[model samples]
Target: MVGAWIWNRNKERVETCSAKAVVLATGGAAKVYQYTTNPDVSSGDGIAMAWRAGCRVANLEFNQFHPTALYHPQARNFLLTEALRGEGAHLKRPDGTRFMPDFDERGELAPRDIVARAIDHEMKRLGVDCMFLDISHKPEAFVRQHFPMIYEKLLGLGIDLTKDPVPVVPAAHYTCGGVMVDDNGRTDVDGLYAIGEVSYTGLHGANRMASNSLLECLVYGWSAAEDITRRLPLAQKVATLPAWDESQVEIPDELVEIPDELVVIQHNWHELRLLMWDYVGLCAPPAGWSAPCGALPCSNRSWMSITPASASRIICWNCAIWCRWRSLSYAARCCVRRAAVCIIPSTIRSRCLTAARRYSRPWLT
Candidate 1:
């Protein structure tokens, strides 16, 4: 059994629940992006918390922007699944001109990266809020039969898919990097396991295919279950752990801060999101990433000075900084590899030595 210490959001009290082991399966961090097909809960709490606990995060450079998400303010992160493109939807300009063929020969069937970039390019060039996806030219009965749910949902939104092209935009959809885990989803911390999107098992290297990622999640879920079951009997014989001590420190009278301080965090939050969306987002170049990369440290310093009352939110800000730092470094490496002639042997040695320190530690116990 795995248990958790739940914190009451209202009363702000910490309560403990215990089990043999603990797992972090808190979904992806798509909420970091301005426009994403993720719920508000997908704010990377697991990734941030695990990193704070000394786990190495990997491959955060590979965030995928799904090619088509509904572009209605009222729809709230609603994804128009890839199956629509599969069943012969055409990406068109507002004037009814098909545009995907100009970007790639595969047209609507191109790989996600190609399609997403094309759509983004068109939107930017045309100065439009969104592009249109049309399948209306197909028989109405066929559209209704194949995509009944989409049809009905769009109808409710006052869109008749049989006549009008659905407005769409590319949105951050999946994160391909997270807590580095092994074949069994075990993290660096003993008795701590991470699975699903929270754990980076190296399955989806650069871009995750829509169908494959779901399959990866299912496979790992079964694998983790089997591994945990096999270890449970031995786990039951372990010595009793000490209970958490509530008296070690005084409880803060408050978690929320004064309005002035709160204003700082809110301002930084808005700036960070817009920076991430515009700079570090899809089509980010190393040079374009410089200003935002520099801003992260400044944001961190400001967030840090805001007092301990908002420590939890500070941790979140730190995590966001870490992700941006890692992404900038990844992009820099790409630029280096493309333009530089040689890698410095000393730098490689230092990186190897640093990696060596964590490699020999106990991962499971």
Candidate 2:
């Protein structure tokens, strides 16, 4: 069950931003993609709200993508936990070559960001769809014990985990930056507090260190509660409070439609994924992504930059990425032939090609 506090009272109007102290236990930002390792609902809404509330947000450029997520037509977004890799698993290449040993000494057990980028580099360099993670070398009993869920899932896929390699790829999974907060989870504004995935507390640093997100959450929560409990006794320390003055406020009749531009929304989601994948994935400098993501200027261009020419190719790319995610399979021989046969456009080119060429940077993750 989801943990939350429900306030039953219905307000006359929706709040633009929250003012009361709040502990947003909302988790990671994984839904900002076509594929993710997190539940579909983890789209950083708390951070968005806190951002609207004029809080200082830091490290937004840091996103952690999981190294090995399952890929299938029906179940491409499911996660294969790090625990599986920790025990003993080999990340493999298309020809069944064990490749992770070359990237790092830790092999399959390296930190997620590093492993993810390693796999990404391999895919991009080889022009392949996806890579594989082999755990089938273990005994069937060991597989069932260490990863019962994975074993059963693979069984349903008509694959035996004790015999074959499991396909996997990196997917956008976590956000490291959030609204700034103090020792008590308090924002710069008084009477305001942010918690959980919505606050940046410097615990994760540039890249998360595995399973520590839960620890950080618990520690920050305890500190915030302790501070509040200590201050509750002197509640009336500020007796003279401001008045509720609604002098020039009026309800507007026009319902301003949200940015319901479907193409734009899809475009931005893809861009955010690609951007984080390129810029924030692993071993990046703290000041690296800061320049492009510095201010309104970059975000502005981002909103304009996505077009049919710019991101439409991603549908094919992401589909290809997901197709071989968990199966160590490839369709390079025939898939392209079938896909390219039915294409017809006035011109397959647009100004988007120029924009991509101009703004392309290695720093984009």
Candidate 3:
């Protein structure tokens, strides 16, 4: 890898950074989904950037939705830790009945994927907005002692963690697949190493076990560091690189313009998020996979046509999100096709596809 073209948000200009090696430790693309526990910066920029630099990503279809995130109008992206369940919290309905045991013998102790699927199934089955995680039966002192931070946070939100059942829902938590990398965290592009949630090292398959992500980061980070150290002596430095040129760039007039373009950009961003949440979320059908494949091109075209030459940070973020969305759509399509040909029986495939069509949303049709 030579360098990267970076946007300087404060300076309001593009700049070039020369580097012999680039490491992408950016977190997952969970922010692509409407309901996610990830921060705003987790927009899949690293994975998109790696893809743009000729790296092959894999298993983008395997997103991990966490089973229980705090579900409240004001509590955006707040996650209720799995430790709550581990400490005997029960997954309950609004009517105060346990539901996890019906789905799995392990109940709340089931794996994250199964638990998330169960919660999603129950929500759709009952037409409910959210489920309840009840640990109210536990001693108040024990709850306070074990989870002081969560207790305090929930208390501040006007929900007592010790006395009341917490409203919860499944949320996009992790991107199990990303830019494909080797054991040493090297991507297809030379000198470009991707580690952490941004790299797909094939450790986490269809579902990632809780806390395994941290271990992957630790191991791969060390391996990459060692590999880079070994290769640094042999690497030849580039003496000169092209500087960023702003000639002929059209700057929008702040005095005359009303900043109406922002509305369009924001609309497109909203549409993109809605599209992913509706079509590419957990429990998506084959039709869901196909819908985004058809719709994303139109969205991309609309975004590109209106985007100015000198784009804002939000516009650049939208571009990264677009890349991530396109990659996800492509991966979803591939998963559907592969499942049809290789995984499912021919008779079962036909039945599944028929069911998918029958249950597909009206807008998707």
lDDT winner:
3
Number of colliding residue pairs in each model:
0, 10, 0
Candidate number that wins on TM-score, 2 or 3: 3
**Consecutive 10-residue window with the lowest summed lDDT within model 2:** 326-335
Write candidate 1's Cα lDDT for 293-340 as tens digits: 555423333333332223434332333333333333333232222222
Worst 10 residues of 1 by lDDT: 356-365
**What's the lDDT for residue 88 in model 3?**
99
CA lDDT of each candidate? 0.66, 0.55, 0.72
For model 2, what is the C-alpha lDDT against the true structure?
Answer: 0.55
TM-score leader: 3
Per-residue lDDT of candidate 3, residues 1-365 (tens digit): 77777655467566789888889998877776667988767777787677756888776666788889999898786889999999999999999999988867899999876687678778878989889999999999999999999999999999999999999989988888888999999999999999999889999886688789999999999999999999988888754557766454444444124355445545655666666666666666665555565564233443332222234433343343334444343443433333334224345333223434443332124
The C-alpha stretches of model 3 lying farther than 4 A from their native spots are: 248-259, 302-309, 313-365
**lDDT rank, highest first?**
3, 1, 2
Question: On a 0 to 100 scale, what is the lDDT of residue 249 in model 3?
Answer: 46
Evaluated at residue 316, the lDDT of candidate 3 is: 43
